[model samples]
Target: MRTKPVSDEKSQRKRFLSGNGFVPFILRRLLTSVLLVFGVTFISFSITQLVPGDPVAANLGQSAYSDPKIVAAFKVQFGLDKPVPVQYVKYVSKLLHGDLGISLSSKRPVLDDLKEYFPATLEIALVAVFLALVVGLLLGIISAVTRDRLPDQIIRVFSLTGVSMPAFWTALTAFYLFFFVLGWAPGTGRLAPGADPPPTVTGLYTVDSLIAGDFSTFKQAVAYLLLPAIVLAIYAIGVLTRFTRASMLEILGNDYVRAARAKGLPEITVIRRHVLRPALLSIITVAGVAFSSLLAGSVLVENVFSWPGLGQYAYRAAVGLDLPGIMGVSMVVATVYITMNLIVDILYRVIDPQMRDAS
Candidate 1:
């Protein structure tokens, strides 16, 4: 009787896993994420170690580098005195306890620095991605509907330009044209000069200002965010426009879409109901990936604009040969990519009936 129950339980559990039981699905994903993070740590640590530079010398500078005792103490402090394998073992140990160690340049805990800088990156990335999605979708739908028309040709040219232009070059041009020539946009940073930041609730200036009912700061924050967000959105906009146009074109040629058109449906109605609805899945997947890329790829834009985000931090870390800082940034970026992909996968499974059934 006990053996029968055990076998029945085993079969039930197997069925649950096979059919996407919520708990088991989430647990399985969590396990995969943990393994991926583990692998990222090893890779990041190894790559950071391979970067040629004396972190101790860089941090201590010429004067301090002459002091043997100081250099030896510094090496011992950051585990540079130990062998590579030993250092990696210690790093993994500290990582398990949530210790990212101290930045050789900033002399602050890497995790703490990440916490401070990540919010800025997240804010810009969110705004940039939202802008990309809206503009890209509109342009894409217009281009598809007006295929071979003037508008389509113009949008295609614009998409090509956006795709080809480097972000730093675009940022400099935008900054110069708007801030200096036209004087339309504010300069860099999250807030304007002499403006006090709103209370720290979400660590995002715009969000926190809105929460604190500070309209003036919120407006200024948006103004400061606009140029950089636009710059960051350019590449993603190009990619999404191309993807959406392709997806829309494919959907518009489907039998149901032709049937709707043949049934005397309005062009707008046919495009919206028949074309866009089916193309949303692919658009969402691309958007999620683009958002993660924006988060990771904003270094140059952030540096050009003097935005105090993770990208800027990473730049400083690399320039100063801050191993812990570099490792921390790498891990955070890797986690963001993995997390975005996981979210997309979950959404795909939830939205597509075939995927859910097959799972």
Candidate 2:
């Protein structure tokens, strides 16, 4: 009787694991991300400290750098004169309180600045990722379905060109053709000159404008967003296309795919339910990596387009030797990267039953 009860309990536990056990997976990812964020903050802070320029001097500028008393007072005020450990403790403490420090350039809080600019970068990145996924997956599936044919050759060559093209060059070329010559895209900003932006709800013009029932503002935002979005997507689209094509080709030749075909399944149904589902593991991995990379790559894209975004802000901070600004941007980027990786890991667990079994 005891053995029977124990067996029933074990079965219940097993069922729970198979059903709701992903909670532990999510917790593990969150815990691991916390550690990574700490490490990023520590390492980035240390390296910025080691950089030759003095923050006090940078903030004070060339004139007051010669004034020892002024410099000393400035360092003390900013806690730069404190020991490294003390400074780190204070910095981390402020970070925990949602204080990202002050941007010496704009005389604004870094958190406030990020709140203002992050949405623009996010808008572009999200659009770029969407375009990449749609175009890339379509091309990849077409290439796989028509393997070794002219269409496959054309897609491979096109993707190769995209991978090889320099982002800066592409940005400049697109700007010239689309904005300057053709006048299709708006000139170098997130809004047309004198065109009013939507009310500052989420800082995302498209959604915020739509929420406010402002179709005119939404249309303008989309026009301004399209060029940079396409430019940012070019590289990611190439990578995802190649990865998806390779994965799909392999899956299309699998025994199950052949069996599905032999069982009189429609080719489309077989590819969709059998081949594509199995191949999504690779697609998800590529998309996650691509999204993270696009966040970093926004620096160049924003610069070229003069978009009022975090990338431009980060670049300005670096040029002015603003350590707080740099650290804030670095931390944000690191958080995004780690969070995306965690999402990808969770997805892998979902897509591959073997991962769940192993856990």
Candidate 3:
């Protein structure tokens, strides 16, 4: 047959790969996520307002029956005397300007405190996530590949136990067993009591210490980080392992996998090349969603371990009914969740070309 010009063939292939329209699909999802974040923030703010006792009273360490004059003055100072609608408008406006308001308990700007603590939380969370992904995926693959074997049973049981245990309980247990009983690590806090916290560049002690060329501080921070990170990773490992196993099982049943087997490809190659890559798309999606929960859930673990992180800050703010602080934490979490979901959406396109075309 007469061959088409090279340019014409390339154009045909491009059209085929492009598939149908995608712009509207991507734009719509992005816009929806933005709206969801806004809605969540608004609801959280409204709920914070409805809780009994004025934030000023909470900060002032007074009962609800405090002097009317004192209460009035407190409200006025914090702008809480204004109508609810007015307050909401101000809050939304300030949020638009990236002003998270002042924390009543700390008497500092909420954003400033958040900036101070966020890096520690992010570091712990990142390390925990990395651990979870590596350990969970490996165990899951091994379990699936060695189905009906001892290793698979052990992994499944471990995942179940991890999922069933609460984070606080796990953290406390780990603290007692590892720190108190075995004397293997420090009991709590990000570093030893006498060790001076390195001067903050990023507020993450590990990174800041390394940047300052203080390896001792960095090592101590890492040692302190292990218990809490492991506690956080346990549940994540459970979730990811289940997801990976399910994805892998489905991928293994596909015709391409059978074809690879028929072609006498090694089992490892068939799995590593044909099965694992496809399975990971789902694993990555689950991991992203699970990561959002990790930060939010770390409050209990941080408290148990005495880690100086955003989770601890959030716990204090919530117990004290600090409106600015609670709102600040909520907004930060909402923003992170939205941002992560967006990144995952984009990554889906990269990992699965069909997703891009369908979009």
Taking all chains together, each candidate's TM-score versus the true structure is 0.93, 0.92, 0.89
Across 192-271, the per-residue lDDT of candidate 2 in tens digits comes to: 88888898888889999999999998999999999999999999999888988999999988998999999998889998
lDDT per residue as tens, model 1, 1-359: 12234467778877656546567787788789989999999998888878888888789978889999989999998889999999999999999999999999989999999999999998999899889989999999999999989999999999989889888899899999999999998888888778898988888999999999999899999999998999999999998998899899999889999899899988999988778977878988998888888975699889888899999999999999999999999889999988988888787767667765663
- Ranked by lDDT from best down, the candidates are 1, 2, 3
RMSD of 3: 5.4
Model 3 clashing residue pairs (backbone): 22-359
Best of the two (1, 3) by TM-score: 1
Q: Is candidate 1 or candidate 2 better by TM-score?
A: 1
Residue 326 Cα positional deviation in candidate 1, in Å, after optimal superposition? 0.5
lDDT computed for candidate 1: 0.88
Q: Show model 2 residue runs off by greater than 4 Å.
A: 1-20, 357-359
Each model's lDDT comes to: 0.88, 0.88, 0.86
Q: How many clashing residue pairs, candidate 1?
A: 0
Superposed model 1: Cα runs more than 4 Å off: 1-15
